[model samples]
Target: PGQVDFYARFSPSPLSMKQFLDFGSVNACEKTSFMFLRRELPVRLANIMKEISLLPDNLLRTPSVQLVQSWYIQSLQELLDFKDKSAEDAKTIYEFTDTVIRIRNRHNDVIPTMAQGVTEYKESFGVDPVTSQNVQYFLDRFYMSRISIRMLLNQHSLLFGGKGSPSYRKHIGSINPNCDVVEVIKDGYENARRLCDLYYVNSPELELEELNAVSPGQTIQVVYVPSHLYHMVFELFKNAMRAT
Candidate 1:
């Protein structure tokens, strides 16, 4: 989970107010919320089947749910080479709405369970010993991410609930007496200089094509985010001066 922290402070400058406003719905916020909800998926096999059995048969009409669920199932199938295909065998169609879907491990599949925060059932009842472990691990990670995403959405919803004015202003942390204005921070030059008090190299020397850190052996698993070499060097120097 990532913690939120950003601050900025400046003297209030008097400005006139505009006319009536029409703030359109923000799609970015909505997209972010959904992405989190689907982050982790394909919970335990038995657990998934159990929840599916309990779901309303009319659930397919919800396009949003179907969209994510289908993608999740396809992903799992591709990873596991699962040849099975059926609504009952669907590994990725599970999800929760206002009520979060969770799991609680318990012995015995035929105890006549009841509804709670989460419900469990055996979907892919049996799997070979070789693949069962990998399958379960994949679902576990998915489940954890799903919970994290939903919590983010819930937090965002609560923050904008019916209430008073919101505070968009931030508190800037740096006040480097040596730092001079150079254009509103592009990439990290200004922020790094403000936070650290120096620039390493000229912008002309920075290359956009570079790898940060790569995961070995797996070409597809390599990590890379195109960024400025100059910014990285400058930030490295700034980070070093903190103790000085």
Candidate 2:
């Protein structure tokens, strides 16, 4: 009950793509960005921990789940430990940024870790359709939240952590205001194709078709994180390749 109340006190803020681009591009590594993350990430991390805790005991007991839970707990604690530190000092800000980067790197294997946990659960105790559906629903939300958190961390790190400049002119942090959809999709397909080729004797080719006709030279673009778009496209193509 106490844990539930603590979790309830911090509501995760909804961030739009525009907001991410605007704030990240303009405030990259600035005091505003530092303070915003300092205040925001702890809440988000805490909420994630709460959600993980609420998973059914059998699933939670899986080694991967337990490991992930520990990571979250440690990350949250580290954030809280730095919460009271002033972001005004340059050294302190640098240290805090380093901490955030470390935390982000620690979660690099989260998707595979969660997938392993699910596999373990399935091998141990078969899931009924209703239970499987419920688990899937939870996983969908969990992965979405994970993406959002990683976006926040990655944007900050790329913009403020001395990484190279944005690859495109319209990019702000990790988001491009005018992301070329076809280019991103092709990049994803290439990656997936490579992976498929490694595993199968015959890998399929990707043919691009323009579903919506544009003017002679106009290209479809949207504001998005290129890596996120790449990841989604890669997953789709990977599944399609498997089916083939």
Candidate 3:
């Protein structure tokens, strides 16, 4: 028998892209209070912070998904808009859209196209990208999740599992799973943090689904006071999407 630790085996993605880097003065006491702190805000200086923290989870995942979907839909329509030979490619992309959309809608029917694409993507990852863990046993849910590309969309950003590369890529090549380890871990941790915050600001007793929200188009303002050379902060800002 052998003892294995997920953390010991992997270097977590550098937290250079945390969502809370914009918070106001992080105080000593505040740091002491929180767990797995991305950052902490002093109650006194918190008002000086600009980035809006409270947004729904589904909504959080939505903005990027919507952006990519817009891109995909446009590419698909270009294939469809008006065409000769393009018509068939358009039709193919259209069928992909239909099949994917159906997968999203419900499972009375999952995918409508050839089990061909299914096999195509399956072999791409080759059972498990990690190649160490029995992927099916480790992620039965992962396999099930891909049943709908709509469900997978941005949710699985890392390709085949390139640490941090987009999970939704049809094929993702990895040089070192160790090198790419941080992205997936950071992503999941960030997600859990966001979900916890969303749940907390809404209701202490409510379930996550209960906290789901309609888009509240509220204006968010910012005022920055920089004190240091933060390559990390710059990187985080670039990585963090301005919600569309």
Leading candidate by TM-score: 2
lDDT of 2 at 148: 80
* Model 1 agreement with the true structure over 1-244: per-residue lDDT tens digits: 0100000111112211110001112232323333333332222332343333334333322343344344434443332332222224223322222222222111112122221111222232334565445445544654544433333333333322222133211101111121211211234544554555434332232223323255433223211111223445557645554534
Candidate 3: which stretches are off by over 4 Å? 1-93, 105-179, 193-244
1 or 3, which is superior by TM-score? 1
Worst 10 residues of 1 by lDDT: 1-10
Q: Residue 195's C-alpha lDDT in candidate 1? A: 57
1-244, model 2: which lDDT tens digit per residue?
3543475478888888878776766555567777888778877877767777788899999999998888887877777776778877888888887888899999999989998998999899988999899889889988988988898888777777776554644577677788889999999998898989899967888888755465656777878878888988999999999999
Ranking by TM-score: 2, 1, 3
Give the TM-scores of the predictions, in the order they appear: 0.22, 0.88, 0.18
Say which candidate scores most in lDDT: 2
The global Cα lDDT (0 to 1) of model 1 is 0.30
Mind sharing the TM-score for model 2? 0.88
lDDT at 153, model 1: 31
